[model samples]
Target: MTSTTAPKPRLSIWMRIGAVLLGLFAALLLLLALFPWDALREPLNRYVSERTGRKFEITRRLDVDLGWRSAAVKLDGVEFANPSWAREPYLVRAERAAFDIRLWPLLSGRVVIPHLALTSPTLGLQMEEDGRRTWALGKNTSDEGTVPVIGLMEVDQGTLDFLAEHLGVDLHAGFSYDSSRGEMPLDFRIKGRYQRQPLMAQGRTGNVLQLNAAGQPPFPLEIDAAAGHTRLKAKGTVAELASLDGIDARFDLKGQNLGDLYGLLGIALPQTSPYALSGELRKRARLWEAAGLKGKLGLSDIGGDMKFDQSQKIPSLSGTLRSRVMDMDDLGPLIGLPPTERSAKAIEGVAPPPSITEVKRARRDSGRKVLPDATLDFERLRAMNADVKYTAERIRNVRELPLDKGSVQIKLKDGVLTLDPLNLGVASGTLAGAIRIDGAQNPAEIRAALEVRGMQLSRLIPKIETMRTSFGKLDGRINLSGHGNSVAGWLGNASGDVAALTGRGQFSNLLLEFMGLDGGEIIKFLLRGDRNVVLRCAAMAFDVDKGTMNSRSVVLDTEDTVFNVSGQASLSKETLDFVVRPQPKDKSILSLRTPLIIGGTFAAPQAGLEAGSLATRGAAALALGALNPLLALAATVETGPGVDADCQEVLAQAKRPASREAAAGAAKAKKQ
Candidate 1:
């Protein structure tokens, strides 16, 4: 048994055949090396062309190394021309594509590519403005049989550059995939930047995005992005690709500064406060049929829920917004308006005049609960209301009257909107009124009413510069009504009334000065008690008509003087026509009855005395007193006219009884 085995050991048919096969392969290689490479160039070109559907060119030099288990193929250039969709061709340009082929898989009639490396690949994707995309796969391929299924061992480093002119979008990306399983695991990074600045935002997002998706159809993805100083993170699973149904899990966003966000978006929000924002979005569906999406947004102290449907043409959306108290002045700069003007001169005229009156009428309209679309809608907005206080050291009006320490409150709508009242505290009282605005109309309307009470004459006289000629401290009430489309129009249609009471006041100085009596003591008088000087008049009341107030008697009480005045005044043009009669108890200081006339606008007023009336009244009074002293005395004592001697005699007679009683008492005592 031992005999033979060792000696005959090897010589099996399979071993002999394997040796022969090896020898034949070596011999074939040697022959192939000796042959010219051009002889096989045509065949190689045909093979590459058929496989890739691209024209292929082979170089003259080909290096084959049997031991290295590889072949080096140098190509001049390669280009892939895609089939045309609408008479326009799509192209892909590559500088070179070099790869390694594993020899072991050759025997199995399979091409197992160990590694594929592309140097520089330029892909051009186009879309017409009419919405025709060039990269769309052909319908014939989808209608035909199943596409070939090939497993690629690995794609090492592949760089692709895509450009689309119509979209103004450029994409540069690098990726790799493992194709062992039917599912190819892919990891890619791409960046996109818009070519034009959007109306809502600006700036470029360089190195803005990074993404990784692994494990194929139902792969998990993670995205991180940076835009200016803002950063965002997202992660989710692509669970069902057929319908793009999946869930997105998110954590709070951080490090997003409001100022920085505005800068990135090229927007300038009103100069308010800086705030932080954080939120999450969940249950996202990107499919067409079941197009549903929901999310929540949180900004600083504000929070809300949002929902949308992509299936709708306009992408229906609904949400609620909430915020904390914010200042109204901060909104001024945002809307390109000045917050406050130190001087009226600094204040710019209203643009086309604010429609304050129109807004008021609209609010008063009976048709709808809402103030109509003419008014700005603050939808579902809520906040803590705050009061705006305005303090000015001194305020000067158009009449050149200066007011001091004036303050007023501006009621704010939830601390977001404000209405300017244009009122000030003066004369130990407050001026109050409301102004309504309607901005929807081309030329708006405005209506306002102001009530003034207990105003001091000393303070008010200067306000009406025309009244400077009148003297004494006066107290009165004024009511003003304004209606018009513009400031000038409103002033032109203004109507008001003033009622005044004067106490121990005198008008002598004003009269003398106005009459041009140089150093001549014409008349000196005093008022003992309260006197009514009523100004009950309407300016532009009836069809731009006017009314007036007239007084029957005005008496001035003093040691020996009595003055009676009567007048009718017109308010619109500020004209006064009056009669002044002066008389003395015992003697006449001015032998005259004067007719005084005041006429002019509020800006400038003039007064004149009639000389003829004064001379006639003086002569008559003197004649009457001389004719009947007793009658004149009676008139002087009771009716304010008399001769000085008669008046004095009557006064002495009235004092004689006390002297007579004293004399009788002394005589009786002496007799006793």
Candidate 2:
């Protein structure tokens, strides 16, 4: 500095840098003002085409309006070709498009659109089962950038077509937006086929420009849609509309059967009657919930909270369900029965749906059947897993059994289903059991064990007035296993043991006389009216092999009479062949006793005296009468040689090893 003397005042480095930057800015502005963006259109298209490995072109004029911090771009015609594997030729086609983007964000690797408009634009999207997606523009090099921000957007005559082979979805959607409508700025309609079923939907939503806004506000929405016979109406708000990340809504759902939803939502459900449900629906990234669920399924009222988790490799469903009033008839579909027409018709007072009608027709063609035949959808069972708890406070419409409250814990995993602790109140007692079904096998396998305790005979036979004053109780047990996909098939091939017994109690004398065919007591009871009698013990035991049930021991003993039963019932043929022999403890007048025969199909049972036994007895009576009129009565007199049953032994035999194994399996599964 001393040597330079007064040569000059040194220029500061800051001033020099400022002057250089000012000159560069001026040069940039001049270049932008004079440049022809149309001339660069082909180059830009080529660059984009090379990057994406797709054809890209600008068919008409391309222009840009330069600004201090933003730029407005306009294109008359644009088109982007689709992948070679796509069904459509083009991925995008637009007659005209324009947008204003902030310039500074680009340097930071962000896209910020201040305004955007599209006219006569069409987009095509395709997805495959192997994780291929058309809309994903080039390779996903990184997951670093935030989603683009858009301030305002407008669309006119825009349409899109989407196909997803993995989901069996094909849809054509039309969308429009109007900023003039502040509350609802977007409108959309979709018509397609999902899971091979016709689908149609229309909805209104909040401004699409705010989908990625900084201070996120609730996105309002309303939708009305139908898929096959399933219908849904929803109204709600979402935290993020772009990804549907968060949602809170209310919805009403009506469907012909709950099982039908498997196709629409990929959720496995047991077949049910026509149903109408309403509830609050909520969703997170990978979870959905239906809370405060209340609805009517046929004649039953059901309410609960359900959660669906899609975070797992296979989706899962969990819930606690309750029914204040459950109509037993409405649950026919659980064991694979066709939808009950009575319940279906009662829901809407209308004819049953086509699906139900078809099922009914098939059932008719199959002829009369006592057990359910509808096959379970094994694939559906494998598609997802579930854990559910259900409780019924009251039950009605049970014809044969007096069922009261009931509860069960249902679990499914890897195509295996279990209903553990399936407890049901019957005749003021409980029928508790466990059942397992393995759908992984081709023909399927089933194991079941059940026990009955403290079932009051008075409540069981309420129709018999004389039993009301009696103090008899019944207990029973059943253990079975089989390979089949249907209730009928399972029972037809089942191997099992069944036992039932009753200890000392009082019973109806008139009923006992009828069962034993004691003419003397029958006439006496008719003359003096019915009365209670002491019941010593009753026991029944059966062994099932190859679908045939053979009576091991069947006996009933009372103060004045004893009855024994022996025969085999063929479950495969649905036939019964049994013989009943009765003996009296005391002699009586006009006691023409003979073996009673029961022989016929289950659908049409027949009971009558054995012809040969009756003939022999008649001949003996005739011979005795010829010898002496008083001696004739001796022909029908009983020797009172019948033995009583040991109640302790009968009950102990009911606890088979199979039952113990089933119980252990259920406990293990519960712990798991």
Candidate 3:
């Protein structure tokens, strides 16, 4: 050709090399299409077994094929043994699995999978107490090996089981995925027991294969679950296929009771009424938060934000809560007391339905007894620590205790709960106090200190007209400590002190005169319908010991009369016994025979004259002339510059003057 074809134009080194490579690639493709890769199954099995540190086997067959665009490897009846510590014999098994390798990567001397498809894959995942898991692939990766990129991973009719014995979790679930309809749809359903409660879950997610890749955010996910009567629903987006790191969603939870959550999570909780909640939930790594929460607590509307940190062995929850005009009745469920709503209905003669739950029945049973014996759930108290605060604009809709506005701070740590400053606006006064409860002990220990100040008595009792009895501001305090399993037990074993004081006020003249044994004035006022009496001061103090409150100094001073009272009230027995003797500034012939007596139980207190007091008047009338002035033996009055005095001082002053009387008879007890 041209004698020498012009020396063939002298082929360049690069063109010659490219031609050789093209011919080789053509030959390789032909080889790949016709090669007998199935014959290497035994060697491949051995290689897989060695690399996985597990007994990997291909029971059926293996095949390699060249498609128009890529090369694919197919494995049949593939199985791998589980870790030695796992109870299951196999960690995973697949009826068939196929992987398509990219041609360009292969041509470049690297392996990359365009897609991995699994058919009927079964997986066994287990977690042990030592934090070891059966799901970990055994010893397959080398430190110097390059990371393989898998563009797509898919499974059809996949089944997975996870067991955590120590945590009482045993779940079996099925997964399915399909992308032919344009949008990838992955769905799963599970059934199991968690924390010993029957659990169930069903959910769907978007584009799981897309989410599997690195640097990719998770797809949208939705889940609905139930544990016992509790129901939960969430719709969200999450990052990372393993750790649920970046998460944002809206969550709604509902149940017949919030306390029932304790059965699913090892947390202590008080019995609660039916509840429903909805909120915005977000999470980052080990931190989780729920904000803009709105819910119904019993019959009240509530809002709050809560955050949890899982950085420690024991998680902690912190939050702020708010409510609008919460009802004290709603709190009844928190303390195992009779439900306030039900109690109110009962008072109106509406019979409630029979209880259906064990908790409800337990509350009903406790209501029958005079004292609370319900054992607290301390297992929950040890589960976690918490700090929370709550505030309310008002509290109403309860007759036994009506409150205005209130705030309470709650802290719990190491099985101890403290309410260091429970402040409330109630009874037109301020009530502030601190309470501590230690559940670490077999019998919980409780201590409390409370004070009431600037309380207008008329605000507490509607029958007391403010116009009639300017009832003045009253101040009081109570301090108590006890160990018990219930509120009743605590009160029954309490030891403390209680005191009350009032500076000046007014009372019904007829009532005070009658109580003071001023017969002439009482009878005269009864005829005229009554008048006002000026009260200078009133005070009462008691020392509680072994569930009994003994009066230290009980005094009521009025312009016309001074009264001294002494008594012991038994909280355990709910009995009362008190004696009142009126000592007027002036002597009265008829008043010597009367001593107001209070006796009986709190449910039915009785007031009457002391025994033989009326008969003493009959006899005293004979000696009235002789003992008229000498009746100073029956009189004692104490008044001091210091507006406030201890009970002992007031009692001492009364007895000091009486000591000079030499124990006179009833004829000297009367006053005018």
Scored by lDDT, the top model is 2
User: Cα RMSD (Å) per model?
Assistant: 22.9, 4.6, 9.8
Q: Give the per-residue lDDT digits (tens) of candidate 2, residues 1-672.
A: 356546544676778999999999999989988898999999989987886678889889889998979999998998988878887787778998898989999898677886767778888888777666665556432222433566555566688898986787999999887778668778889999988899999988764434444455676888999988898999988776555667899999988789989888888888888888999999988899999999988779999999999999989999999999899778877787666667876556234654445665666544345667777788997999999999999999876788999999999999999899799999998999898889999688887878889998777877775444475788887777777888888878777777777888887878877877777778888898888888887878777775777787787778878787899898878899999998777666666668889998876789999999889988988999999989888887766565655656655554442344333432332232
Worst 10 residues of 2 by lDDT: 663-672
> How many residue pairs clash in each candidate at the backbone level?
6, 0, 6
* TM-scores for the candidates: 0.30, 0.86, 0.72
Residue 251 lDDT in candidate 1? 34
Clashing pairs in 1: 355-438, 356-436, 356-437, 357-445, 357-446, 636-641
lDDT of 2: 0.79
User: Per-residue lDDT of 1-672 in model 1, one digit per residue for the tens?
Assistant: 455545655668778999999999989988867756556667876775565454545434333334356554433344545535423232444555554565766665445443333445445555556544434332232321212222221233355555555655455566545444233245556665433211111111111111112233344555555443345555554443334455444533333123333343322122222223444454445322112222211111334443434453323333333333222222222222222222111212212212223434555543222111222222211212223444444333323332333434433333133335545555444554444323222233333434444445445555333433333443333332333333333334344333333434333343432232211123332333222232211111111112233442243433344444556555433455666544444333233335555554343556666667646654565777798755433322223352222323322322222232222322221221
Compute the lDDT of residue 397 as modeled in candidate 1. Answer: 38
**Clashing pairs in model 3?**
268-380, 587-672, 588-671, 588-672, 591-670, 592-670
Local distance difference test, each candidate: 0.38, 0.79, 0.70
lDDT of 1 at 529: 27
Global CA lDDT of candidate 1, please?
0.38
